[model samples]
Target: MSTVIEIDRLSKSYVVPVRGAGVRASIVSLVKRKTRTVEAVKEISLSVEAGEVVGFLGPNGAGKTTTLKMLSGLLHPTGGTASVLGFEPWKRNNDFLRQITLVMGQRNQLIWDIPVIDSFDRNRVIYRLTREEYRERLDELVELLELGELLSKPVRNLSLGERMKCEVAAALLHHPRILFLDEPTLGLDVSMQRRLRTFVEQYNKRTGATVLLTSHYMADVEALCPRVVVIHHGELLFDGKLADLVRKFSAQKTLVLELEESQEDLSRFGQVVSQEGSRATLRVPKQDTAEVTARILRELKVQDLNVADPPIDEIIDQVFSRGMA
Candidate 1:
């Protein structure tokens, strides 16, 4: 696979004004001009291959958006280098801009008062697409996104989910080779989010567009991306497959048992995570799970037993709580 996105020591920093609580101190500081340096994105290196859908995972204020902005030529980096599709991103080459699209879930690029088709037409003019190309691409997007009646309605009248679908359709009118999505499914309902994910996966399949997506929703990451780059405090933490992340961060498996009798304790078998009546959940070391299950069945009342890995959210939470230790 060819490398579509590359970064070496890419970083962005900001100097924020510092103000004291007291009025006198605030006045004094205004004259003195005190500021502190903040590293929104540390020196992070990344490489993305063509036709790959990768997840950019991080908590809020973790520099996910900052990095995306630099990659899309919307923000100039304070230091280091980045190349997208063989062009420097900060230079904002017209050809480079035409081949990339950035979509923020909470932000809208569509005209609120205009019908969705009009906004798409605006994109058509901006990208310098001919009428025939625009019509073909628009037809394809409308079909893929199921934007039949929705295109005739004004953007302000559409629901959040509908508006998002339109936003995606508008962004894809130019058939960008690279797509940057920041929180694309942030506030939608579960069903809407799933639909958007499915659409994106299909688009990538048909067009082979390279995508770098950032989202707080784990479901979006799991559904659409096979590889994930985890970041925290503006630094890269892990860059690998999602399954590798689970294995690296998750130390235990889950064991659930339904006892024949109510109110019985099974603490001796493993770490009891939750106990309610005859049903109890246990956390056992991965290597010791089989042993613990055998002991539980042999020593305790035989009943229904279930074994599985712990939830992905819990494992991720543990990693964040530990702070990259």
Candidate 2:
């Protein structure tokens, strides 16, 4: 596959004034301003292939959003080189802008007090889409998004979930070749979040658009993206499959046992994580998982037992902690 996104030694920094809290420092700062340089993104490089869906993950204060902004042509990078769809993103050329679409959850592009379809029509004009192309794409998206009735209602009158659905449709009307989704499922109900994830998967398959999705919700990453790029302190940490990340940093597995009765001691098997009614959970070392499972089944009246790897969230937390440490 061709390289849709290529970043080389990309970096960004900011200069801000700093001063003491008290009156003396405040007065001194007025005369002699003290400024400090803050590095929001350090030199980081990665290549994304065409039609690939990759997750961009990082803790708060990391450079996830900053890197995305630079890629989407929304912000100028302080240093380094980057390109998307064979065009320099920071240049903000019309040809480049027409091929890329960015959807930010907190920021709305649709006008209030207008029907959702009208907003979509406005986007059609902005993208200079022909009438037939606009109609075809609109009908396809509305059916896939199940926005038949919602499109007729005013955007201001619709619920948050409804409005977000419209926002996604508006962004896709131009059929952008690349998609930058920053927390697209933020603040949505669980069902709505799942629905959006499904929509992303379908859109990618149907359009073959390269996508870089940054979401705090693991469900979104697990369902849509097989590869992930993790950043911390404005630096790259891991760039690979999610399972590889968990296996590399996580040294323990969880063992869940269904006991025949409650109040039975199972600490001898492993470190008990939780116990409720007839179920008990234990954490055991990866190498000793098989031995511990055998011992539990051999030594106790176990109704059922299962062994699984650590949760993705726990593995990611460890990745950040170790990287920051």
C-alpha lDDT (0 to 100) for residue 236 of candidate 2 = 87
**What are the per-residue Cα lDDT tens digits for candidate 2 across 1-325?**
8999999999999999999899999999999999999999999999999999999888888888999999999999998999899999988999999999999998899989988888998999999999999999999999999999998898899899988999999999999999999999999999999999999999999999999999898888988999999889899888999888778888899999898878988888889999998999999999999999888888888999888987888888887887743
Q: Show model 1 residue runs off by greater than 4 Å.
A: 258-262, 276-278, 301-304
* Candidate 2, number of clashes: 0
lDDT of 1 by residue, 133-206 (tens): 99999999889889999999999999999999999999999999999999999899999999999999999999
- Residue 319 error, candidate 2, Å: 2.1
In terms of TM-score, the best-performing candidate is: 2
lDDT of each: 0.93, 0.91
List pairs with backbone clashes in candidate 1.
none
Superposing every Cα of model 1 onto the true structure, what RMSD results? 1.6
- After the best TM-score superposition of candidate 2, give how far the Cα of residue 17 lies from its true spot, in angstroms: 1.4
| Candidate 2 regions with alpha-carbon error over 4 angstroms | none
Question: TM-scores of the models, in the given order?
Answer: 0.95, 0.96
